[model samples]
Target: MAKDDMDKQPDSVSSVLKVFGILQALGEEREHGITELSQRVMMSKSTVYRFLQTMKSLGYVSQEGESEKYALTMKLFELGAKALQNVDLIRSADIQMRELSRQTRETIHLGALEEDSIVYIHKIDSLYNLRMYSRIGRRNPLYSTAIGKVLLAWRDRHEAEEILSHVVFTPSTARTLTSKEALLSALDKVHSQGFGEDNEEQEEGLRCIAVPVFDRFGVVIAGLSLSFPTIRFSEEGKSGYVKMLHEAARRISEQMGYHSYPF
Candidate 1:
């Protein structure tokens, strides 16, 4: 690495720590002026002012009128709520997911959208020796998996596209949708049907079906999926799996405090 890059690394980390320190100080009270915040965080007044301005622009902090006092905004609470929701969601989803595994004897997954990708947060191994190989914390492309499709399908069309606008569509199999337009079209079908499919898209000879798990506010929070091999695939089986997944997802969503489960 260049000398400039090496020298800048520590500065970047220090900046982050300083920003958090200022936020902590601001959060300790209703509001504080730049001078008071600087004293609390042990930073220069100009430095505190700069960070506050940046946070204000990002909606995490708000300046009171034309005054120098700045207060932390509700944006931080909104982010914290999302984190807490996911924790509750995973704990409650386990019971339903295990039941689905027992019924189908197939690999089951619970995934959620993370950035431009779908991240596997929970999984149940198949009873059979042949099963889809996956584990928690693994990330897969949003354009090539059943869970990914369901995650994007429930969103507004334009918002979904914008989420994936910067992502490079790399095909993992011949069946993988390799463009935003193609994926968008499939998303329409998935949205209408209340489920999504991966027919040898992420990997050859592997098929998966998934349905959405909604939060109490009726927002799609996660996806529940069943995976099996082509050799075991059947039209009737697929339909049954879809029904089973929807049922399991409904129960999981209810456990997370959502009484209404669409499809």
Candidate 2:
């Protein structure tokens, strides 16, 4: 009986995968007719139409007028925005992030761990011409950059090792750490100091300081980072900037009702 059940599981999983593939194909193209979606997903027209009907019933996909084409509905964004708003940490930290940018006169970013990468949720641009180029929807590797390091430092050693198992460490610049051992050592320093530094690791001529932001439950929910040009901060100046960054992160965490962890 157990063997029979296990055999049926693969078929069920394959059906789910096919449905998701059809949805993804529709999302990539602005609007896809039945023929186009069937070709893109390598499924028959009948199968594609059935999947589209189901998705439309769920409000995940919609049909265009008289064209027999399907497009994604706005329901996905409504769901995503609701989830973002429900995160107490993000809601509480917005004002503090603005203040951090005002005080440091540098670009400030708020990022959260998404799967194996960090996704930027908010950004405050620097007043100067030279600044980090990151948009709100950008995702970067978790093994590089200050924000990534700070978030990784908060995880347990076992969890960190697991997360790093599949990370590609291609060197972005001469200063980028390409070895797992070197990254683990940096994580150790970030854990001890309660902050992380990126000395032109992601891009040449740019430096960033980052600290972890925790929620009321004491779990690291996101990272707050201040980025600027390397020419503006000497080694001594970098230390001062690290202090300011740590302080700003602490204040944001406090506003989020996180009082258990001391930085």
Model 2 ranges with Cα > 4 A deviation: 1-82, 85-87
Angstrom error at residue 185, model 1? 1.5
TM-score for all models, in order of appearance: 0.88, 0.68
Candidate 1 yields a Cα-based lDDT of 0.89
Model 2 residue 42 lDDT score: 75
Which residue window of length 10 is worst by lDDT in model 2?
Answer: 1-10
Assess candidate 2 and give its TM-score to the true structure: 0.68
Residue 205 displacement (Å), model 2: 0.4
What clash count goes with each model? 0, 0
Model 1, 250: alpha-carbon shift in Å?
1.1
